[model samples]
Target: MSVPVLLVVEDDRALSAMLAELFEGEGYRVDTVYDGQQGMHRGLTGGYDAIIVDRGLPVMDGADLVALLRSKGVTTPALILTARGSVEDRVEGLDAGAQDYLLKPFEVPELLARVRALLRRIDNAATVVVAGPLRLDRVTRRVSGETPDRAEVELSEREAALLGTLMAAPKRVFSRAQLLASVFDGAESAGAVDLYVHYLRRKLGKQVIRTVHGTGYRFGME
Candidate 1:
């Protein structure tokens, strides 16, 4: 399996570094960004297994960021970590779409435990899945279509993640909005999704992914 990716959104450089080290030490691939705007961009696009976001941030607040992600169906598990630890604050955090809330000056063990608990709930997705004759490797970001005699084609990071998302839930019929939220991170427009669909079709072959008319796209036909 590919190492799970985690996104940490904290403005404090020192704290971000510390958290990155903490999670990286625990066998997770960590990405750190300062401020809420950057966090929103990365969180939406990184395809992280989990996210740790600070409540108080410049550009955008943690609650707003999480709310936007949730509105767009970016359901990556999120944990709100901030110094605001009032009873109402926890309720607000949870209401904003965070899976867990951790106060500042927290014990590392407790934090780790909460993260693990969130991750544990996810069905471990495979690193590779076959869509028709196309073989996609999420870990290596490689897609092999056609036959062995054909050259193996490499996919861009976004392409690989997008393909992985589709193949992971074969025939699930992901709408363009759903694909934008889960695959594109809610940053890219729906047209971007269409463009990638074209790109994937050109490279992998048209039959690899199916368009369900006005509904959305699915991986291979039944």
Candidate 2:
């Protein structure tokens, strides 16, 4: 599995570095930005597994940043950090779209625990995976484009499993052997990987999956 990517949008340089070190030590790929504007830019395109943002941020408020992300259909889990612990402040942050809130001067262990909880919740609740214009509903085994008039296409069991495996770790290249083991359970030959790739491309469009030459394939919706 690919390392989980995390975005830290904290203005304090020291704190950001500490967060980076902390999460990286825990096996996550961490990216840090010092302001809300940069946070918004990264949040929109980063494909991060989770985000940590300070409530008070420069250029744009962290709450506003989270709100904008939700408006754009970016459902990556978020945890808001703030010194403000008032009920109203907490409510505002939660209302804006953060899944969890942590006050400043928190214990490191508690912070880690909260982030783990957020990740677990997201993992359990993610029945639909959205990549750019395409939305894959795992429950229904169907894929659909964003346009209102676009029809949803049902996928075969193996096809859906293959697509879900790739979508789960977007941008990570998966070789035929890896895919065959994970999706085909080593029952199918490596060539079957290419055959199913053809099947998916035929149903979803040529751009649905990108071949990476000798490496393998990665999600291609971008």
Candidate 3:
């Protein structure tokens, strides 16, 4: 059985360590990245059960990344983190396609609850699912097509998180900040939404998400 893994994308060293400890205590294997580019790569390759992303990464900004991921067909559940937690900020994050958003300086209990909710959302089968040209299994973390038994696509925790997020929303847009809190917990993860979006596109395949042209993005559309 594959132990559920999680990827943490944050720049603050102290905060990242603290989050790592928290997740570890919660029985999740953790992978850490400092910048948006690194986070994107990890999200693309690391097979994690979930992803926690920040809004202010180094290589790429978080907003663009979220949009990118939705553009691809990766339906991972993502939580966005943002220091600027104003209504507009929150709207921006949601517009990019995040499942939820968390403001900075939050309590651990709420964080844990949010995590639980995200997992529940990810596992909600009665809920609608949206994907194109690929076979995907969330519980087994298996994605394949072609043979109806073989052709599979592997994804890291972050990628998986994004997949779940898109699956939950279908066609809504979520901005970078929303993705960070909903996905990464806003400690330092939301900043890389853009890079993650790019990573998602590469993995889920092209034309999965359509760009909003100067805004965020939308998934499962014509």
Candidate 4:
């Protein structure tokens, strides 16, 4: 399974290093930047699952970077980290497109929880979704499905996410563009969606994902 990638934008050398180490220890891919200009450039170009930004940055400031990304339709979730703990500061950060705001002096567990929460929001699959004999566990990022030989199989993260999306609205056809926008986080292509559908079908039987003929795909038991 691919590790979830993160971009950390912080000017404090010690703090930035600490965060990168912490998140890496937590089984994530981390990229650290010392200033907002570099951060923004990386954030825009990189296929990051989420971003952690400090409010007071040297070149661009965290809020402006986040707001600019939002304006340009970069939907990757962002968390604001700063010493400014006022209510107004929190609101401003959120208003500028940061999903969550955390004060600098925060516990590691709380930060982990907030980051997980952001990921769940992006997944939009916090609850389990079921279709036929298939069950997808969002929390575990697992899919319980029977193979042709009647054995159960565990799916990868992307597979589970795609299956959950299809099961979320069962029998409803989803276009490639729509699936691309919802499922792929800029790291995958539209062809990848087709490939994943083929993968799911192979795992759960060809009847699992139905082709909608020139439109896209749908979920149903054959």
Candidate 5:
């Protein structure tokens, strides 16, 4: 498997270098830029799996960089690198299209977790679809069977995995722990799982998935 590429934009040379080394060690191709101008140029023009941008930059601000990228229709998932840990700052980053916010002085594990989460969301949006009546193609991540409802649906790998597990035992509830083991792998979150379930409900429509209220979630037998 080819290493996923990440563009790290931070004016802090030491920090960027550290991130490059860390991510490179974990099977990722890291491209690091230390100035906002170069960061924007690389981030916008380069093909990257994800972007980690610092909010403060020289020559160009990080927010402006992201905003410009968005204007040009760049939709790559972005994670903001901010020293300000205030809620308002985090909100600002999110509003600027930053998917997740990481404060300074965080551990490497947390960064890896957030990166995995972002990638999961991307992969999820390209896999799974309802083909036709009594037909589903969660594998190969596309709709092939006839009579597809013309609705665009995608499930994250984790969601697809969990759904597959549940389908293996249709009409059975799998608790949170079960799903954490069989589904999340390492980037598991109950809220993320619930969010994906909500997405499936919208794709499948009319209560196809049921929540057991206390235990976890299950796919209803068709």
Candidate 6:
């Protein structure tokens, strides 16, 4: 399975380093930023599976960052970490679009558990992914074009995973290295990405994925 990618937005350098190490040790790919502005930039474009942010941050507050991300249609699950314990503070975080909240000085086990829970919720809700004319049923590993006459096509596990990764962030172009890491878990060489793209095009049509010359590939058929 592809490792989950997490973004940690904490101003405390020590805490951020600890979180990066913790999640990485748990087999997740982690990206850390020290302030809310950087958090917002990364969160908008990183295509992360989950984000952990501190409530008080330089440049922008975590709540505002979350709200802005939601406004931009970034549905990646977010958890707020803060020292504030007020019921109102928690409400504000939730209302601003965070899926979970973790208070500071929390037990490591509980934090990990909560993160897992958030991921589980997202996984449950993400059974179906629709991008343009394409619809993917992750459970069935089926890709179907929206046209009435287009028959659904079953994909091998790797092909399905690769397509799912591209479709997950339709606007983002992914490099071969990124695809290799995300879908193949770096078990396969980067050339494997090209091979699979050819396979998908043969099955789903040439328009299913677009190559961006030097950059990599992005979701096509829009």
lDDT per residue (tens digit) for residues 74-145 in model 5: 567888888888987776667555678899878899999999887666544322223123234455433222
Candidate 4: minimum summed lDDT over ten consecutive residues — where? 121-130
Against the unseen true structure, what C-alpha lDDT does each candidate score?
0.79, 0.82, 0.65, 0.78, 0.66, 0.83
- Model 6 per-residue lDDT tens digits across residues 1-222: 889999999999999999999999999999999987799789878999899999999977887677656534477899999999999899878866689999998999999998898777644444676778898877798888753358989999888888877776566667887677557756988999999999998898888899999999988966
In the range 1-222, model 2's lDDT, one tens digit per residue, is: 888899999999999999999999999999999998799889979999899999999977787677656534468899999999999888878766689999999999999998888777644445776667787887788888842348889999888878876665555567787677557757979999999999998888877889999989887886
Q: Write the per-residue lDDT of candidate 1 for residues 108-132, one digit (tens) a residue.
A: 9999999998787663433566655
Tens digit of per-residue lDDT, candidate 3, span 184-206? 64666554766777876776555
Task: Tell me the number of clashing residue pairs for each predicted model.
Answer: 1, 0, 74, 0, 2, 0
Question: How do all the candidates rank in terms of lDDT, highest first?
Answer: 6, 2, 1, 4, 5, 3
**Candidate 1: segments with Cα more than 4 A from true spot:** 123-222
Q: Whole-model lDDT for model 5 versus the true structure? A: 0.66
Model 6 residue 185 lDDT?
55
C-alpha TM-score for every candidate: 0.56, 0.56, 0.56, 0.55, 0.54, 0.56
| Number of the candidate with higher lDDT, 2 or 4 | 2
Model 6 alpha-carbon miss at residue 149, Å: 36
lDDT of candidate 4 over 31-73, digit per residue (tens): 9999977887788789889999999999676876776555334
Candidate that scores best on lDDT:
6
lDDT, residue 198, model 2: 98
